[model samples]
Target chain A: MDNTESIYEKSVVPNTMGTKSFNIDNLFLVAFFGGVIPMVVLGAKNAKWLNISKKLIYMLIIFGAALLVTKLVFVAMITSGSLDLDNTTLNISYRVGSVLLFIAFKLVLNKAFHQHMVVCGKMEALLKPALIWIVVGIVVEFVLVVAVSM
Target chain B: MCEEQYANDRKMIEHYFSMDRYEDARPIIENLLLSDPQDPETLYLMGVVYLSREQYTEARELVQEALRNGYNPEYAFFFIGLTYQEQKMYAEAEDAYLRSLEINPNQANVNAAYGYLMLLTGHDEKAIKLLDEAIRIDPDDSAVNDYVYRFYLAKNDGSNQAQYLQRTMEIARNEQEKLINIAVYHLVKEDTKTAEEYLRQLYLLDPTNKHVLEVLEEINRTNHMLFLPNRLIDKIGGPAVFYIGFIILVLVLTWADINSIAIVILALYLITAGYTWLAPLLYRLFVKGKI
Candidate 1:
């Protein structure tokens, strides 16, 4: 009982409230990835598992385009010196691009495998990509948290 | 025998009315008015025509005539209220809306308008209750939902913020409008990254959007401030950091002293700015490539 209590005190007790010392801004960085990581993993995993190369490409392109645009916009805003704390356009773009990419990737991969390739027996050949995509999402989110908190 | 003709003309009158051809509907409605000058439906049509033509005074008169002639007056009352609202006569508008509610409480527009008036008059609690009812009755109405969302935001009631924002998002038609709510929610919740994502999407979707442009700039500045490196600033070295470099350059014209400080400061500034600029770029270029 003493050993168990000591372990608990050293480990879980400190974080019982699940609140971090990070300020509100840091909290935002964590939350931003909350939506992002899921989208990324789901997107990549679905593309691989479904064998939807075209759709994957579309997703990647949209994602890249969105990120690129956001980077430019952020730079411009900072230069101009009129940054709002509650700007929502960033989140919306990520979500929109993620969704469009998901649909496009899934459809294209399914079509490619089903139409041109000669898969004799598997109905679920693309599960690996889907699982990997989920992992990627988690990792991305973790990295974002670290970046903000660090 | 006259029933068939009455039905035919009523249908034609309604059909023309629905098509917004008020002038075309006039003859049919006028015949009905001639046959039964006290006809509520006929009076209502006449009022509508007058209302469409910006003849508010005449419309009010006709609508009142319809009410006195034993017309049900619910629709007429709604129009009268609308006229009063357009005229900016809040008191008269409120009275008409109250009269409308008395006849048919299910009319969500009346409820919403009444709530708006109450809000304007500083009866917040009552206005919110009425607006809540209005939303309940017409969940699909974007205008009413937006009003409620703004109300909660104004009150700084963070708890209900998400729910109202979600409603606004659901009803928003365009990507730009949808981004506004997403940004606000993430912003209030202090989720800057997600807020940034939404802002980015808006910028891409509509580069000319001033709102998105403003937010992008804001987040970028905050991100820079939050992530700035103390080491980079310190590299500027003691007294020379702010003034001595400039002073030495102006007074002594010593190239070495000026060059050293200038190089150090310039390098530090570039590295700081570069890191600020390149951090996301590097993330997107190398790390996010897989995603």
Candidate 2:
């Protein structure tokens, strides 16, 4: 091959498909308001956009389920007088739990999130989807908490 | 000419262009164009020469002609973007950059250029994402590093600014760039005496650099002691710091069962947060008259 042809080959990359995903900052905002459920749901959606492995998506769901179960168990214990915790301590524990879930969301999807931003350079707005998910998550969380308490 | 001879001539032209000896390459480029006026590669290289000479109209026409003749469309579009940007035709520049990016989103230079355009147009959030992507794609690109450093500097994000400034310093290609980075490094480190020394050297090298003069003036105007509070807040008092601090305060109050003392501490924390948010703005207004 000629030098010019070789240089062209080196410089030109094959065109790949680009897909838009929700911004990580918006996902963080969802997590702050609606906690683990909506965070995992939105993260899974982003994983789909990024074409992340299905196995990683399953792992994320499982991680979120485990955190929810632990929260439910903690609530049940508190309601049954088995673990006597004051209001201040309970508030702190809830904050810590939310933070842990948020960290997990970040760890599981950080690479894909950055890759999406780099490749797409634009993100789908999260407002409508985030609202729907957060409302659904809140209702389900409320029901589970009430059931656990009973 | 034989094919091999033509290849050798093209190689020689490329060598001259790479070394920034556009004048030396011009005669050969003219000959190649004279022999085969429709050759896309020759047309593109001639476009680059025009671009270097600030002949934007000729550069754009040649690049577009190359694109029509099936040259690398992504690179042609990127070159078109650069010409438009130099001419301050921002909307056309953005369109050209988007076209280039649409063809190959992985291009680091296109991403950085688009990010800079976004920054100029006041779309800061989008600029941050695009610039971050460019850095991820090519961390060694000094131009992109400089843009990110300047972005962080404008936001008063001292940690990020320091990080990119160091990267720019490490990859500085020329003496002027190296001198500027070193001076800014010392300035950010609050070593005004050392920074002034380097800035003076830079001033002697390039008397037309207004940034050097402005920084020197600012250094002369402000007392370092009075600026300490503002600098410290900018350096270590971002939102994440305050949020973590508040979390720790809550944990401490709960664990220690110090309700009465907690009120005083919380009030003090609020005051600190307020000061952290306001100190830089107040300093700019009072000291620099910038805002």
Candidate 3:
């Protein structure tokens, strides 16, 4: 059917009972904006360790923390492997994980944060290490999404 | 005086269009048309806005006015063709498409539309050839794939249908494909469980997948009776892990109910704290300092 016809059908007979339609393109767009772009922006602007060059420190802190947390969750889930897909337990776990990933993404855009601060005259010194944190955040999110889905 | 007023009118028309306030654009465009009744650009633009809103009759009149005024008549033809298609006037659509193609044969949309019109007219072979030509010009043309998919599906030739469906999936280029392909593959293999699992994932990813909606309804109605046999969860190591954890939790709860509850609550708290606080502290202590 044409997109117009499909749209008409959807509007005329709205699927009121079920979840909303998910377009992969839409999902990817959401991820790019909500997860990726913000992370990149934040990573570029943020400073680490009261200096601009210590970005690596920020990267390690976020990634190490996220990785360790994900590992623990994986172990728990593996150990208690249950068939209760009905429970919101997995959903909660994933949402929390995704949010962590989001924060990591923000770290990647750390320079953007630092730059904003600098522009605002809050920080006189620019730390370059924050850039590494941004890269780490982006990589972490990319890996986690692929790993979890797989 | 005339030149300046007309320029201002055009500017005002563009401003309203930019703001996406089409209702506001109408009076300005109409006034422009009244002042300079011979202006093709204003007529064409008015047609375009109306066409976007699916106001076919008004769009047609405005477009024809542009054509009559000797403006870019090919675009007028194209929009008229699209409006005809919207109205399901396939014969008129085909003629208008042909007219537009005659004017601008190189335009991908014209070829794609002509191809789609042919498909709707049951000229499958011609439609396919035209669509292929369009694809060669613009490989990502949506209308061409949509029409071709429709044609093959109607033909009910399994292999051909699958082939076109695969094309559509590729063109779709979304995460939805991840769920869709897995579900369909399992369904074809008669592995209902795996199919159902993928379907569930598909629903979670995008609840709007019509095929998934249908399968979910069928499964629910049958009370999950029609199951695909192949086990994907095992291959992925998800099912086993989930089952083991669930069984252990159940056993612990059954024996020392109160103690298990307390332990569960404590464990939850510890896990949350570790993820949010302790883990970050350890990272800052060791990895952050080192790296």
Candidate 4:
């Protein structure tokens, strides 16, 4: 018992109850509304206020490229007359492929971006938008599935 | 048994240890051991110091000796588990952890350590259950929050990862450690630029940290797009020729009533020739023998 007390006293335990906080840049919160247009508008409006790193831009590019490739491939197949399969199946395949690629891209980008946010002390600011984007992706997929079934 | 004198000695020993005055603590520990050679608590305390010193072999021997000397079995088992863990002996470590838990399941850091073991062994669900159990039992431990952060990071659960990392950063040991953690978090995600910012902060805090310097060097080495060949199209002069040929070929086929198969051959020839000639040159100039 005495040994335990001694050890406890010997350890400099950090105050785990420090006011839990994160950096909140309003410009970041506003930039995450929706759609490509809103994003461009946000960037244009907050060009000076925001600090967009090149790594994030690259992540966006890679993510966008994944979806873009699906379209490019679909267009190529149509132009080349390569599909003898059912049109519906091809359309479904393309759409599903695009959605899956987007999710894959989003997963990677989120991991990268969230880590960056954490390092920058913007962890709390990151979570809300990250959650929003994930929910939006899920809803979009669910709506697409429903539309297809109908 | 002079209980008050023992308590005073214990306080003095703790005072030295807390200040990281290991040199001062050692002589006192030696004196205590000489006086009461059978004291399990003294042996255990020495084992704890050895564990921190990373003398795993000596630590294991000392802790085992403490257990034999009738030390607190739970703590003895816990320290033994920790020694095994440091050595990456998962099976032995798990056995020790289970033994410790059997004695006292509520041992504060044990559940977290075992959860880490579970995670390493690919039982993520079990790991979470145990880790969550640890949190319920000891919510105030920043080390528990760190374990939670590692769990989220391993599972690629971004929101939780961010949340727990934030918690960790709040109570980190020092600016250097916090900066390193942040840098590592970003580095693992391959976000070198963001990682560099944290690493730069760490460098400012401790310029002698080789790990920070190495990561900075690695990021610099990998940012190869800075050296990519530019204006290759202008150098090749292929775009102008291709477009001019395209226009003439389109006019011939659509308006001049030329041989369709022959024009197709000519167009294909232009496309293939342009690629075959320029591709090797570009490859040699930009990509040959480079990682």
Question: Against the true structure, what is model 1's DockQ?
Answer: 0.01
Against the true structure, whose TM-score is highest? 4
Docking quality class, candidate 3:
incorrect
Question: Per lDDT, what order, best first?
Answer: 2, 4, 1, 3
- Model 1 reproduces a share of the real contacts of 0.00
Candidate 2 clashing pairs, residues 3+ apart or interchain:
none
Error of 2 at B170 (Å): 11
Clashing pairs in 4: none
Better of 3 and 4 by TM-score: 4
Tens-place lDDT per residue, model 1, A1-150, is 223112111111111111011111111222233344444444444344433456555666567456535644654564466665333454444544444444343344443333211112124333344345456755764565344434
Q: Rank the candidates by DockQ, best first.
A: 2, 4, 3, 1
Q: Taking the tens digit of each residue's C-alpha lDDT, what string does model 3 give over A9-102?
A: 1111211111111111112212223343333333323323223345554563565456446644564555466333433454444444444444
RMSD of 3: 23.2
Q: What is the Å distance of residue B47 in model 3 from its true position?
A: 1.3
Give residue A12's lDDT in candidate 3 (0 to 100): 12
Q: Write one digit per residue (lDDT tens) for candidate 3, span B172-222.
A: 646565466657545544466688898998888766556578887655533
TM-score of each: 0.35, 0.44, 0.35, 0.47
lDDT of 2 by residue, A4-81 (tens): 112111121123234457766446557657877788888888877666679978887887888788778888998999
